[model samples]
Target chain A: MSDTADLTFLQTLRRVLHQERQIESGTVIYNLPVPFGFRSS
Target chain B: MQFALTEDQTAVRDMARGFADEKIAPHALKWDEDKHLPLDVIREAAALGIGGIYIKDDVGGSGMSRFDAALIFEALATGCPAVSSFISIHNMAAWMIDGFGSLQQRRKWLPQLCTMEKVASYCLTEPGAGSDAAALRTRAVRDGDHYVVNGQKQFISGGGVSDIYVTMVRTGAEGAGGISALVIDGKTPGVSFGANERKMGWNAQPTRAVIFENARVPVAHRLGDEGIGFKIAMAGLDGGRLNIAACSLGGAQAALDKSLAYMKVRKAFGKRLDEFQALQFKVADMATELEAARTFLWRAAASLDAKSPDASMLCAMAKRFATDVGFEVANDALQLHGGYGYLSEYGIEKIVRDLRVHQILEGTNEIMRVIISRKLIEGAR
Candidate 1:
């Protein structure tokens, strides 16, 4: 629930952020819906 | 071929690292424990001249390149990623205003922001928007000479503390084409800050929602051309992601450095822990992956500096790789520390907690994967 979007982008937006892996099949606009509201403190 | 830090940049990074260690690092535990950082340390940082990295001197800034700014980010995040986030966001917002704001807007805002007289926030991700920013539902309807903004923005870092918000709204039509960037004055009527939401990490800088119920922003507050808000926001965030990745690299650097020092001195089972091959391999992997990530981050920044078509793809890649690497490194450091890593005095647990957010914000690592894979397919085609 906590975010650093205001003072910093240091906290990567949960939706768009991730560890990227090269796709064997080329494509654009990958739909990876984020699991928001998960608190990991 | 070029990865070495410039002389001045090295000096700046060193100074910031020194400041963080001497000032922010020792105090980071207490601040994270209570989730409050002193303003005086930030004020002191402002005086150091690296405060306005990548902004021009004529605009009351240090005029350092994005590369130099990345170095500063990495260095400062070493001591405390939370406090570093606060300072870096100020600079990032300053960069956008300087780059895209009108002369009047710049003259009105940059001096105060650059000099740290006023803190700033970049507001783009709404509750419904997130990665699908083109679908952002925040509305800014024109009424008379001013625009009345309505809707809520979640995950705003300097929400309550910032004097201004670089707000993105739907001004023209629909989709990405309709988005317009506006500089909403913090004290504007109908502009109100939500209570600081207690976050898992980066508590030093408050993150909250901003609600605008017909918040009237002046016509003069618009940045760049009409309906170019999404463009401006995207441009700013490309660099924003790079800087965030730098913060990851920086924090990971600190975590690795600390863990290595800890492993050597701590004796277990009648032997130094560094002699343990399993632990050594983990450290080795951490160091190697971090180096790869750092290389990737700088390469991405350089590509942006060169305005490469690949810059966009590289930004996501660097952000995704560095952040994941950061999380891995932090978690491994904690494991290496065993039970002590979970304790606050060691500060490893806090670093672990802080790094957990890296994979989540500034475009979640999931979205980064999406962006990169999309680019991969398109380029191949």
Candidate 2:
């Protein structure tokens, strides 16, 4: 696994939620940063 | 504000709906009658590549967002919730193991799992631990290379039929700190399956009790650290709730669709049932609530996909609200159908029964309230 290949799960989540472009081919972008207020409810 | 489905989401959704119409709808009535859960149906679904939903492309997967998976479930569930739920549980099991398992573990298992060659179960609740999963007595003591697992899992979805169980057992002492997750293959010695549960509804999906009697799970099978099982399960449930909510949305959609078709032709005191202003109001209400829930479902799922701080709580809210609304809307649709809805042939009855369980499973509505309320009371939640 390359250095970039090992993105932490949360970091990967952040990128997916924040960015729209493909992280790689065929994988759907899953960028969804949870807002803080909703976290606190 | 833009809570609309993208072109891709819409395509997957339509494909799922079409697949269900062709594959699930005709047999749903008979499957319900025989109480035979066709595991092959699920295997065929897994072959679609939606089954490996959350896992990466490298691990025999076509990575898709949780939100996208939710869309698929809702669409299939619109045709047959029993089939949809079974697929959901299998996907749930696959997601956890894929997320936490080691590369060698992923390499060995993900291929079979993603492809639906083998099915997996998630075992957490026990005879004594329904809502209080942490109070579970299933224990796993360290014995060198293997952990000796001894415990019982209750209401296990895909129970006897599953090839593997991603189960939770206590590794340390007591309470939340002691629990850990381990993957156990069905062929393992000392592992046994309890009889399928006879339930109020959702009979087409077989749920049963599972007993782990000195089942030896390799240390390599252990997920996360010794004390991380509770956290792992909690995190999984946060998303699981959302997926279950999606199932509710699907079933509700099915019910509404049936009711709409019925109302257009069925006559009452007037030309047609839908011609009545009262019935029109009811239709309007169901549509309005469903619209709200669909948007909420996607927003919550998107939040989780983003890892937003509020993702978990939003998921809880979405699960609670969507399922509750689904139950109400489905019941009302049944009401609109009158005596015909009660008949098995209408299929509205089945949707009602299946959606009812949505309120209880994947973390009950009560637990959802607790989670939502806890978030409100605690700081930095």
TM-score list, all predictions: 0.88, 0.89
Best by DockQ: 2
**Candidate chain B TM-scores, in order:** 0.97, 0.97
Give each model's whole-structure lDDT.
0.79, 0.81
Per-residue lDDT of model 2, residues B116-148, tens digit only = 788888899999998888898999988999999
Any runs in candidate 2 off by more than 4 Å, and if so which?
Answer: A1-41
What would the per-residue lDDT of candidate 1 be over residues B268-348, giving only the tens digit for each residue?
999899999988999999999999999888889889888899898899999999999998999899889989998889888
List DockQ, one per candidate, in order.
0.02, 0.04
Pairs of colliding residues, candidate 2:
A16-A31, A17-A31, A17-A32, A32-B306, A33-B306, A33-B308, A34-B308, A34-B309, A39-B310
lDDT for position B213 in model 2: 87
DockQ of 2: 0.04
DockQ of 1: 0.02
Question: Largest TM-score belongs to which candidate?
Answer: 2
